[model samples]
Target chain A: MMGDNEEILQQAADWRALGKGVALATVVSTWGSSPRPVGAKLALEQEGAFIGSVSGGCVEGAVIEEGLKAIADGKPRLLSFGVSNDRAWEVGLACGGKIQVFVERVE
Target chain B: MKLGFLQKALAASREGRPAVLATNLTNGLQTFIEATETAGDLTLDAAALQAIRKAVTEDRNATIETADGPVFIEVFNPRLRCVIVGAVHIAQPLARMAALTGYLVTVVDPRTAFASDARFPDVVLSTDWPDEAMEKLKPNRRTAVVTLTHDPKLDDPALSVALRSDAFYIGALGSKKTHAARCKRLQALGFNEEELARIHGPVGLDIGAISPAEIAIAIMAQITQVLRAEPQSDREAA
Candidate 1:
């Protein structure tokens, strides 16, 4: 299929098969005016490489950081990010929304 | 990330079967659930398995809570399919539009003159009889069947098979009188009123579509509406 879901999962599977550490970040839930809907995915590798997007460009850098850490620790983490007034401009979540992303190492 | 499970799930995706991959967020334990399985103990309790099955059926991903922990149920639904049982002028635009909407489109007709690969570029062309071709295609719930040929020989057989299958949308191109006659013929062949209700006879929304392209657009819009809206039977019950 042309959708990004299969492609992202296939990428993680391929990276895992190649013995490269991989972490998957999925937008499990969203609130208010999130950029991407729930079930959006962002995949990351051990070397800070990534494909797909969970929040378009708003929180990718932070997600990438969490993804790399998840790959290192092997413990899954649920990350929450929102467009708060103080950090809204800094994180670029101008959509005025919040999202919960579940990041886990692809075992 | 069991290689065997991943491989099987990939194969399922390729083969157009709905599958669910339930992964334990706490421990990374994973297992695959086929469509036919009754949510049995596949590393998940009954409730979580039901949720996964529901997500797979709805073609969406869901997170389920269970005794173990939160499990992310990743749903791998097959691509939506549009099986057009004619290769007329309308079929041209219809096939293209269906493809643009992310549907794997197939145009079937025995007429070599119209069902040419040149006419329907980038669409699966089946030059077999409509019934035989559809049998091979195996229209599922994710499939929408549309019959454009006015000939009963072509359209009826396709509709017969499509009505028997799990195709979500079945539309036949004809006028009100033509559709009434077609319904009578189908009723003579033993189809009941409720089953016949599934077919959108004067196919497409009442858009006053004149040209073949416009008619195709109307049909596509109706298909999309039916797909996104609640099921007619469900809505009626509600």
Candidate 2:
């Protein structure tokens, strides 16, 4: 099997070549007992297709929502999720950790 | 996050070269950093570039605080490789364990009887002579070379090539006396004292290992220790 990062990036490139909008989300930083390490990635297509991961299914839904926005606006976003934030609870990131994800459109 | 930079990073990974993608959070600008070149829209100052280069050499991903903002530097290093110069009993287990640990393992031996598919089910086997195989492999900083033939004709030539390469680890299977004799022979061929010291003769951590499989475990542990040791700059500063 191909490495996860390579596979995700390759898929993103393929999607872009097909005239589909794609956004890439990367975990830039983490604190406490984070589920995924820093530099983990999650790629999303405009049609709601996604690959790779930035968390243990705790914050991916929120990240994908932000990724979709990025794809639509062609603007990058930095999202912070932590137990201290009410949004984190809403997003179910109650794993006693915090993560910062950078979402950007694949230009 | 430009497509061009992503493709460049992918190409570098495919070629087994180290690379880094530095993203400026403030402006969404990015730069791709390779060993001898830099590309992309983001221009970095000397200090930032120096920090990125250090991160690349150390194989670390970091978010550095720059005046512009937090720039996340994602390092992409080549996968580790293990080149076994013999297909002995120890090699069988060693190869399997190395592959399990994510190493691209290759076993080199001219003796088809020893390097047969039955002996190494899923491992890459090279039937070339020891020296020739070493020449083709060209072991580098991400590679470990181990000679286990216990035959001077096969192991010695391979050791000669491995010693001259940039391989991170070099090991030879032998006892103290045998290693001493081997060192003498290598010295006669113009290897310096420091170069000879690079080889882990008697090849494994001293765990009192007795069986071939146990010895393989010890060697694998030793290799991991070497691989995860302090980065060069930290070791030098210490």
Candidate 3:
């Protein structure tokens, strides 16, 4: 079987080949005891189909929302989540760690 | 994040080529960096490229601050490999355990009766002589070589080849006295003390393992320690 990251990229490429909008989100950096390490990936298609993850489910919903926006706008975005941010609490990043995610459209 | 770059990254992963994907945060520009080639539009300076190469070699991913901006470098390295130079009973469990730990494993033995497919399911079996098999394997820094056969005719040639290669771990199974005699013979073959010292004879951590299965466990544990522990000096100090 292919590794998780390889599967994610392969899925994203397959989605793009099918003419579906695809976006890839990566855990670019982390601070404290982040659940996922840097280089973890989450690939999302326009209709909300997803593969892999950048967090331990706490921030994946928010990341998928941002990924959809990136797919729509053709603009890449860097998102940060931490206990210090109020949105982090709303998104349930209750692990007391911080993570930066880079979301980009797979053109 | 171009499709071409993604395809290239997939190819590198499948081909077991070490590579790095550097994505610039400022402009969303990206580049795929391999040892001999690169792709994408992002232009990296000498320092940044050097850092990327370092990360690839160390099998690490990091976000680096460069003059252009913050670039996230994601490294992809090939899987580790373990080559067992015997198809003995101990090799069965060791091969399974090593495979579970994510090492690509190969078992080598010239005896067709012992290295049969029924004995080793889902494993790459080599019915070639130890020296010929070791030559074909060409053990590298990511490889671990272990000689389970106590026969010097088989194990000696494999050990000699392993010592000459960059394999991160080299082990031989035998009693202490047997290992001493083996060392003496290898020394006669011109392997100096330093080179021969690299062989972990008596082959496992000094656990009082009696059964073949238990011995396999002990050997696996020692291999894990050598692979994951700090550098030799720090470990010796500890």
Candidate 4:
């Protein structure tokens, strides 16, 4: 009954119901050469289990780390990544774009 | 147990209904709107309600500004459908092609032999009369209807039903002379020129197609054209 994104969100809920903590990261907005469009999502579980993508391999690892943190703290976090900074190259935003992702624990 | 707005939206989506879900980002309050049904128990301010209706019509997803701040609107539309009125040679390929392109294809014909499972392997088959079949199908804006049955009793009834409905596209297979005769007959039935014009007789683009497969290709191309192009621009191009 769910669309692609909703399906992933449902998975998050299902996993949480099974006693695994889960966090959802959603692309709230993006600018200039961002690989994933806005509303793209990624869900991560407490045990390093994850599904879906927020970005094309560029920032998923960092987002997953943030997702895990969100699952632990039970608070939402807004993350911003851009290629303008020197550390962007190491984090995979080499496409000269900026993206704002909102990470929240799914209850 | 009561369902939340998200669960209600999911149920409506699975049923292929036109639905919109609007969420106030700050407060997380949600409004679920089913375009075809009554507003039911949900209540919202005029601005939010108007925005949701607009999003449903446009099939657009967006962030809307309301008195209560920004609301994220997600729109859900049913999958596209193609109802072919004849299980003829051209329809064989047409059904396969439409299915390949993500359409839920249904082949309708009263002739049981032609509408057999062997002919339309994966397609939905209806062996009822055209009018009865069409009534059951209930062609809507998301549906495209093509009549390959040359017989007036068969094709005419289906064409009339489609023309009256909001079906996005209506096509009929025939030659120019045959089309002229068919149009004249419909005009006798009190259909005005504008209504009659909706029928794309001698269906499909002018692609110089001859074989059944080629004709099916042309028909699918024309249906896609009508779907994506503006009516005025399509007329100009035609």
User: Which candidate number has the best TM-score?
Assistant: 3
Provide the lowest-lDDT 10-residue window in model 2 chain B: B229-238
lDDT of 3 by residue, B34-86 (tens): 77788889999998988887887777787899988999998877667899999
Task: Quote the true-contact fraction of every model.
Answer: 0.18, 0.41, 0.52, 0.02
Docking verdict class for candidate 4: incorrect
Q: Rank all candidate structures by their TM-score, best first, as comma-separated numbers.
A: 3, 1, 2, 4
CA shift of B68, model 2, Å:
3.0
Report the interface RMSD that candidate 1 achieves against the true structure, in angstroms. 5.0
Q: Quote the lDDT for A28 in model 3.
A: 89
Put down candidate 2 lDDT per residue, B98-192, tens digits, no spaces: 98777889999999999999999999999999999999999998899999999999999999999999999999999999999999999999999
Per-prediction TM-score? 0.77, 0.75, 0.80, 0.68
Worst 10 residues of 1 chain A by lDDT: A1-10
- Counting clashing residue pairs in each candidate, in order, gives 0, 0, 0, 0
Across A1-107, the per-residue lDDT of candidate 2 in tens digits comes to 11357778889999999999999999888777777777788899999899989999999999999999999999999998888877855875767778899999999
Give candidate 1 regions above 4 Å deviation: A1-4, A7-23, A32-37, A42-77, A83-87, A90-97, A104-107, B1-6, B35-43, B53-60, B207-214, B231-238
Better of 1 and 3 by DockQ: 3
Clashing pairs in 1: none
lDDT (Cα) of model 2: 0.88
The order of the candidates by DockQ, greatest first, is 3, 2, 1, 4
Model 1: TM-score, first chain? 0.90
DockQ comparisons of all candidates to the true complex: 0.29, 0.30, 0.37, 0.15
Candidate 4: residue B39 Cα off by (Å): 12
